[model samples]
Target chain A: MTLWQILILASIACFALKLTGYVIPPALLTRPTPARVANLLTVALLAGLIAVQTLGQGQSLVLDARVPAILAAAGLYALKVPFIVVVAVAALVAAGIRLVT
Target chain B: MTLTPETNGAARASLAVGLATAAYGISFGALATAAGLDVWQTCFMSLVMFTGGSQFALVGVIASGGVAAGPSAIASAALLGSRNVIYALRMSPVVGSGWMKRIAAAHLTIDESVAVSTAQSTPAAQRVGFWLTGLLVFVGWNLTTLVGALIGNLIGDVSAYGLDAAAAAAFLGLLWPRLKHLQAQAVAVVAAVAAALLTPVVAPGLPVIIAAIVAVVFGLTDWLGTRTTSDTEGAPLA
Candidate 1:
């Protein structure tokens, strides 16, 4: 399948996800169980994505130059650094590591 | 009938955050192009998918040699995007029930837009913040994507400039402010461990999905525990 085909499908799917908000009765989402689940979902998924991106490469997982950047990002973020600076810090750390070794 | 003098943080946030989001799009455009997408495909993804996380997920999978049109890539992006549905729900009453606003808001219901709008002190400000932020981001994102795609190779060795770490670092930045709650931090730890452990054995995208199950379990257990405590307190054994 071509990338275009995939784009079409993905776009439609994403559009549906957005439309679901207006479609689902607000009552269901307002319920405690669903609301709580929704609240927790974003954090978990984001962390999960970070781990995968940092630790894994393609099909195989390995430690690499990405580690220091992730750690730096964590530290700067904890310091309440701005988002762009946090990204720049991580990138600089990673680039420095690659330069040294 | 006029909207009051812009009197709140929402307008300021929208413009600032919209620019911030646009700055990030450079990496997305460069990455997508590097991953073998043509300039237009990269732009189209930004135009169509519109959500940052999902677009990155798609490009990430493709960069890793996974099938772009395959189930895993599509499914992963969709899952990341489904969070927008939740955003939509929270925003609906605020944006209103009209077809025009509803459709427009649906397109703009992303993390930053929602956050900026939420920070508003009034409903009028929310509507203004949401629309203004969304429009700026939409314009900025697409334009940067084009620039990035065209200048792909010139950027050269994104790792050399720390661009490679950009995605992970950005995600961590997004996650940090939310970690104030101890339970939220625990959930993040659980997810990180799960994704790390699963990455070696599972496919590229599956680990994230697998890790999300941990959150669902955590939420369920807490909910059930609260219910039980409430029930038991209501009726003591006499």
Candidate 2:
């Protein structure tokens, strides 16, 4: 499928998921297992994304400027920096590193 | 208009949270463009998906894997959005009745809105908070996304700006808040390592999904066990 198709399809699926909560019987959907699984699944997907964006180049992992950039981002996040600032600073860090190297 | 303190407080909270969370849209917009989405596509995503986490994850998958990973991208995005279903279940009572209201509420059923709504003491305050936050964020996020997308398009070469790194950082920021517990931390570590290892062997999108499955299995085993920390400790997701 094309990216546009995927985009619309994904949006529809997400919307369906949201609508399900309203349509489904609340008592039946309140199980603890699904909730816990969903929560942890989010964490897992995010972690995987972080790893891929930082190191993966197509099929290979390469060390580059993104490493320090992400580290700097983590540092800012630790210090309670705002989300937008963290992202901007991370890009700056990576760009700066690339320019220097 | 006359308002109770609770209603006033909810409004105030909603404004603060909405603006703060919507600010992240600029980052998401830039990253989505850098990931190869056109401005219209990016805006459409903000308008239609309407969920920050899922939008970012979808664009993140495309960034790493390209259009060829469309299936996995859709899966990741939809799965990330599954939380909204749970949010909706909780929000149903607060939304009251009427198909029109329910439909609109479903569209606005996101992490920020839910958090803002649940923070209130009364149904009236909760409804006020939910609607206010949802509308404010929807508008602010889309506007910022447009601004960021234009900037991204003007920049042309995405890597020169290190938006790739910025994308990683954004994901890191999202994951950071959820890492207070040992189980959560362990899941993150295992997922990261698994994805890193699998990326070279499998397709781009498959690694993340596979790693997620592996991490979920590990997490469910409770190998690292659970901690007694409060679930509400972290800042709400954008």
Candidate 3:
């Protein structure tokens, strides 16, 4: 498909995702079962996205700088550094590693 | 009408975060241009997909030669974006009025806006922060994307200068702040490991889905544990 087609399709899909929750009754959202399920689903979805970005590569795994970057990010986060600093540190470290080795 | 402290704070925080996020849109635009998309296409993605992950995924996929690179790239992006739906749900209670407002809210409901808004102590702050962050990011991201795309077209090969790191770094920037809690840390570790393990085996984005499942399971169990104990007090369980 063309770029426009892709954009249109993707846009539609995103809007649909956003709209689905809105259209659902607010009462349904407040219900215990749905609320619990939604919480789980959110966590799961985030995990999946992080995994795919960090790990998956062109339908396969490379496990290069991204791995180390993630580790560094985690470490910085553990140390309680600010978000921007952690990300910059990780990127710098990854870039250094890539430059050196 | 007088503005409460919460509303005032929300407005300020939103502006700060939105502006910060918008600055990164330049990087995205530059990256997209380097990947071979025209300025309009890049802007289109910014306007339509709007989500950073999906936009990056789309550009990456297109750069590598469309679906030949991997169909899962798009799917993975979509999955990653799934979290926003939850954020919107939570936000609906606070900022769910008016058709125009709702549409605008949905567009602005990103991780930064949600976290900042939720972190605020009071309702007014939450409302202010949410809208401010949303509007600022929306405007900033689009403008930056345009600038980056234009610059990228002129610069060529941004990877050589480490431009590629910007997006990943931006993502890390977003994820870092939430690590304050032990649960958040645990979830990050579990998700990262899961992603690493599955990336090589599954489709490009499937690993994310798998990791998400793991996180959901952990979160659910934790929720259940908390709920069971809270029930003892004869209070409504969250």
Candidate 4:
């Protein structure tokens, strides 16, 4: 498909996605189970995205500097360091490891 | 009617978030350029399908050659972006009733804006935070994508300098603030593990969906317990 086609399709899809929540009846969404699910879904999806970005290769999993980065990030987060600082420290550590080995 | 101090504070906070969000747009532009999209195409993506997660997913898919660089990538990203649907639903009531404001609200309905606005205690603050973050991120993300793309062109391959980490870092920045609650942390851990395990087996976005489903299950159980306790309590005097 052409770039325009891609963008159009993507935009339509995105608009629909944004619209779905508003279109759904509040009664259904506000239900205890569904509301809880929605709340949980946000964190879960975020975690999933982070995991894939940090760990997965094109199609495989690689336990390289990303492991150490994750470890460092988890530690930084545990220590209540700022988020940017945690990420920067993790990335720097990863880069350092890459430089060394 | 006079503007209260709270309203002013809300506006200031929203503006701050919006400006910060816009800075990220430069990165998005740079990454999209690096991934092989033209300027107009990148701008178009930012303007129309303004969600960052889906946009990043689309570009990532294209860069990796996981899906064809057309509707398939968009579809995958859109599926991954379905969570925003839920966000918009919760936001509608808070969004109030002007056509212009509604359109603006739709454009600004991203994760950061939604979170910031929803977390606010008052309605005025929520509105201010949502619009400010949304608009700021929108502008920031697009401009940054362009900047990143231009820089990418100059540098040849961004991977050499680890420019790819920009997106991941930006996401981490956003995610870190939300990890305040135990349930949120547990959900993150479970979902991350699930996604990692599923990545090898499923398509690009499917792991995220699976993780979301798992989170939903956990949330349902939690909600059920909370409801049971509330029911049992029967409005006891505080």
* TM-score of decoy 3: 0.73
Better of 2 and 3 by DockQ: 2
DockQ for the candidates, in order: 0.61, 0.77, 0.37, 0.49
**TM-score for chain A as predicted in candidate 4:** 0.74
Residue B40 error, candidate 1, Å: 1.5
Angstrom error of the Cα, residue B226, model 3: value is 5.4
Candidate number that wins on TM-score, 3 or 4: 4
Best-fitting candidate, scored by lDDT: 2
Measured against the true chain A, the candidates' chain A TM-scores are 0.86, 0.96, 0.72, 0.74
Model 2 CAPRI quality: medium
For all predictions in the order shown, the interface RMSD in Å is 3.2, 1.5, 4.4, 3.9
Top-scoring candidate (TM-score): 2
lDDT, residue B220, model 2: 57
State each candidate's clash count.
0, 0, 16, 16
Return the top candidate by DockQ. Answer: 2
lDDT of 3 by residue, B145-222 (tens): 999898888877644434445444444544554444455566666776876676666554455556666555755566
**Against the true structure, what is every candidate's RMSD?**
6.8, 1.7, 5.7, 6.0
Can you tell me the DockQ of model 1?
0.61
Q: Tally clashing residue pairs in candidate 1.
A: 0
In angstroms, how far off is B198's CA in candidate 1?
Answer: 1.4
- Where model 3 places Cα greater than 4 Å from the true spot, the runs are A31-101, B1-6, B34-36, B53-66, B69-71, B115-127, B163-167, B181-183, B223-238
Better of 2 and 3 by lDDT: 2
Whole-model alpha-carbon lDDT for candidate 4: 0.64
Q: Place model 1 in a CAPRI quality band.
A: medium
Q: Write the per-residue lDDT of candidate 2 for residues A1-101, one digit (tens) a residue.
A: 88899999999999999999999999875665556566777889999999999999999999999999999999999999998999999999999999989
Over the stretch B121-208, how does candidate 4's per-residue lDDT look in tens digits? 8887777767766766776667766775676567656444444454455455545655656666787888889988988897665666
